[model samples]
Target: MPADAAAWHAWQAHQHQQRQRAAAQAAAARPSWTRRLRPAPPAPVRAATLVAALVAGLAFALLLGDGMGPGLALAALPAMAAAFTAARAAHRKARPWTLAWVAGCAALLVIPALRDSAWPSTLAILCTALLGALALHGSRTWPGVLLSPLGFADAAVSGIGWAWSGLHAVGRGSKERWLPVAKAAAVAVGLLLLFGTLFSSADAAFADLLGDLMPDISLVDGPLRIVLFLFGALVALTAARAAAAPLRWDRIEVAPGTPRSRIEWALPLILLNLLFAGFNAVQLAVLFGGYDKVLKSTHLTYAEYARQGFWQLLWATLLTLAVIALALRWAPRGKPGDRRFVRVVLGVLCALTLVVVASALRRMDLYVDAYGLTQLRVSVAAMELWLGLVIVLIVAAGVFGARWLPRAVVGSAAGAVLVFGLLSPDGMVAERNVARFEETGKIDLAYFQSLSADAVPALDRLPEPKRSCALRGINDELSAAGDTPWYATSLGEYRAREILRERPVTAPYEVCSRLGSFGSRIEY
Candidate 1:
C-alpha cells in the first residue's frame, strides 16, 4: 500500500511539471504586441490612474466656464471623485462608512451655497476627499490624518517612481525598434508646418482662412497651459493612488538623552501667560465693556479702533501657537510636576488666546459693519474663528492628555473649513453690505461691483436701481461671453445670466469698464 501511494504522488508531480512547461512555451509563442509593453499594474493602480486622468481633464475643461465660483467648484470634482474611484479599485470589500463619506462629498458639491464660493468650495472638496480616503483605508490615527496632504503628494512621487521602474524593466534593445517611428513623426510634423506656412503666405485667401482658424496662442500662455496640465495630472494621479493606500504615521518618539530642566520651559510660559492675562483683563474692561467705553478710551472712530489691533492680534495668535509647540517639544514629559505645570500654562495660554481671538473677531465685525464685508474680511474672520476653536481643543488636550488630540484637531479644522465654505462668504458679504446700504442709505458701488459671481444671488435679492447699478458690470461681461457652449456653462453664471435676462439693466454705464480677457473682443 505504501509503494502504490508513492507512485501516485510521483505521477501527480510529473503532470504538474508538464503543465507548467506547456504554459511557459505558449506564453513565449505569443506575439510581442500581444503582450503588454509593460507589465500591467495592479487593478487598483490602473483604475485610479485612468479615473484621475479623466477627472483632471474634466476639471481643466471646466476652468473655461463662465463664472469663477462655479467653475472652481466644478474643477474640484476630480479630487472628490478620486476618493470614490480609488476605494472601489483597492478594496474588494468596503464598509458602510466609506460609502457615506463619498455620498456626503457628492451632496456638498450639489448644494447651491457651497457651489458658488471658490475658496469654500475648494476647501470642502479637499476635506471631503481626505475624510473619504481615511474611511476607506480604515485609518483613524490623528498624525496620519493631519499628514494626509503630504501622503497624497508623496503618492505622486511614488507613481513617477513606478513609471521609472517600468521603463527600466523594458529591455534596452526595445528602444531601437521605436526610434524609426519617432523620427518619422518628427519629420512629418516639421514638413507639415513648413508647407502650411508657405501655402498660407503665397495665397491671400488661404492666409485669411488659416489666420481665422488658428487660435491666438501667446508665447507665455501656450507653454503655461502644457505645464499646468502636466502638474495637475500628476497631482490628480497622486491623490487617487493615495486614497487606495493610505500612509500610516509610525515614527518612534525618541526621548532626549538629556532633557531640559523644567525652569527653562516653565519660566517663559509663565511670563507669557501673565502678559496674556493682563491683556485679557484690559480687553474685558475696554474692548467688551460698551460702545460708549470704547468711544471714550480711543478718540478714533469705531472703524479705526476696530482696525488698529486686528492684524497685530492675528500675528500674536500665530506666534503664540508656534511658542506653545516649541515649549512642548522641549519641556520634559517624564517629570510629573513639570508635565502638570506645562499643561496648566498651555491651558491658560490657550484660554487667553481665545480672548484675543474674540477681540480680533469683534474688531473685524465692527470694521465690516462700518465699511461693509469683503472677501478678505470674511476669510480673516472665518480663519480667526477656526483658530479660536483650535485653541479650545488645545486646552482640552492639556486637561485630558494627547491620545485623541491630533484627530480631534484635524477633524475640527476640517469641519470648520467645510462650515465656512458652505456659508458662501461672497454672497454673505454682498447680502450684508446691501442690508447695510438699506439701513445707512449709502453703498460702496465700486466694491459691490467688483465682487464675483458668488455675490450674484445676493445682488439679485436687491431692489432695482441699486440692483441695476450693481449688476451693470456683470451683465456687460455676461453679454460679451458671445454664447458660451453648454460644456462651459456654470451654475453661478447661468443663474446670473438668467436674472439679467429677466430683469434687463436700465441704468446707463460703460460696458465692462475694465474688460477682462473673455470680454476683450467686444467693441466697448
Candidate 2:
C-alpha cells in the first residue's frame, strides 16, 4: 500500500498494451464474423429479445414442480405485490427482464412455513431470475440501477439472490469479467439443487430403509427472507459505492500506483461465501431441529427465536469480518510471483478449516449433550479461517484466473504454508498423537461429549497437563461435602465412573451432525 507505486504503474501499462494487442489479434481473426454479428448487440433488439426471454424464463419457473408446490403457488402474494409495486417498476430498467424476474418469483413462490420440496424448483426459480437480470442489463435497453435491489429480494427467495444482482449488474457479455465469478455460486447452487433433488429422492428411500440419516429438506422461510433483505442491502450498498466511484479505468487497466488492493477483491470474495454458508447453516439449524438447541428448557417462544437471532447476527458478523481480514492479508494478488505474507495466513487457514467442519459436526452435540462455548468457539474459529481461504481462492481463481489469478494465489498459498510451517509456527499439519500423550488435563464430561470415544481412555490414561474448566466445576461439585455444599465427591466420581463403564462409546453419526452437540455423551 505504501510503496512500489511506480513499479505497479509500469507493470499495469505493460499489461494494458498486451491486452490491446490480443484484442487486435482476435478482431483481425474475426473480421468477417464481426460483419455478420455486430461487435456490440443493438440496444433495442437487446431489450426486445429479453421480452421473449422473460416469457421463457417465466415459463421455466412455473414448470418447476418441487420448490413451489402447485397447491401453494398462490402463497406468493406478498412477493408478487412487491415485484409489481409501482415504486419498483418506476425504478428498474423498464425492460421485459424486469417482468420476467417478477414472474420467476411468482412461479417459484412457496408458502412461508410449509417448506415443501426445495431442490430443482428453487434452483429453477433462481436461475431464471438470474438469466432475466442478465438479459435485461446486457442489452442497453435499461440500466441496473432501478431494478437490481428488488430484483435481489425477488431473486433471493430462490437462493443466490445477492449473486443474481451482481450477475445482472456485471452484464452477460462480460463473461470474461471477474464479477460473474461471484455468480459461479449461483451455478453451484443450481448444481447442488439438481443433485440435491436426486440425493433427496434417494435419501428418502434410504430414510425408509436406514432411518432418515439426513434431516428432511426445507425451504428458506419468510423470516429468512427478511434477514436476506437486510443482508442484500448491505451487499448492494457496498457494490453501489464501489460502482459509483468512477472506475479510474486507467488505474484498473494499469494496476494502480498502489499494488492492486487485494481487499478490493478479497472482501467481496469472503463475504459472498460467508453470507451463503451462514444463510444455509441457519436454514439447517432451524429446519432440522426446530431451533430448540438455542431454546431454554421452559418453553418455545418468540423470545427464544429473537434471542437466537441476536446470537446469529453476533456470530455471523464477527466471523465474517475476521474472514475478510484474513483474506486481505494472506490470499495472493498481483503479479504471479508476489508471494508476500501468504504462508502465515495459509497456516492459520488450514487449522481453521478443520475447526469449522468440526463445529458443524458438533452442532448436534450441543442439542443432545448441552455442549458449551469452548467447543463452539474453537469450531467457529477454525471454520472462519478455512472458509475465508477457500472462498477467496475459488472466486479469484475462477473469475480473475482468466489471467492466472487463482493459480498464483493458490500455488503461493500452498508454497507459503509449506515453507512457513517448516520455518515457523505453521506446518503441513501437526499430528499430535504422541505429544497429545504429553499434554493431558482434567476436563468436564460435557466438554468431551462431542469428542471421540477414544478420548476417554486417553484422558484417563494421561496426567492433568491442563485443568479443564468443566473438570474444575465438576471437581468443585465433588470437593464440598457440607450438608448442601455443591461438589463432586468420591461418591460423584464413583457414580460417574460406573455410568461411564456401562455406557457404550459410539454415537449415531446422524445425531453428531446437527447444530448443537457433536456427541458429548449419548443418553439412551
TM-score of each candidate? 0.66, 0.25
Candidate 1 residue pairs in backbone clash: none
Model 1, runs deviating above 4 Å: 1-114, 122-148, 157-237, 243-249, 252-259, 287-289, 461-463, 482-490, 510-524
What is the TM-score (0 to 1) of candidate 1?
A: 0.66
lDDT (10s digit) by residue, model 1, range 1-524: 45644564465456446645664576577765323211222232343445455567546543532333334445556755665575566553566655555555555554333344456766776776676555544444544555545555556776665433323332222444446656996899899889999999899999877765443345656455565456656656665665555554423133544557878767888888899999888888884578777777678888888888898999999998888777777878786887887787788888889899998998888888888888888888888988888888888878877776765665676667767766667778888988887899766566655565667777876675667777776766667766544434556666777777788877555532332212322110
lDDT for every model? Answer: 0.64, 0.36
lDDT for each residue of candidate 2 in 228-323, tens digit (9 for 90 to 100): 444433333222222211111111121223433555644565456555556556655655866566465536553434433433533554564466
The worst-scoring run of ten residues by lDDT in candidate 2 lies at 424-433
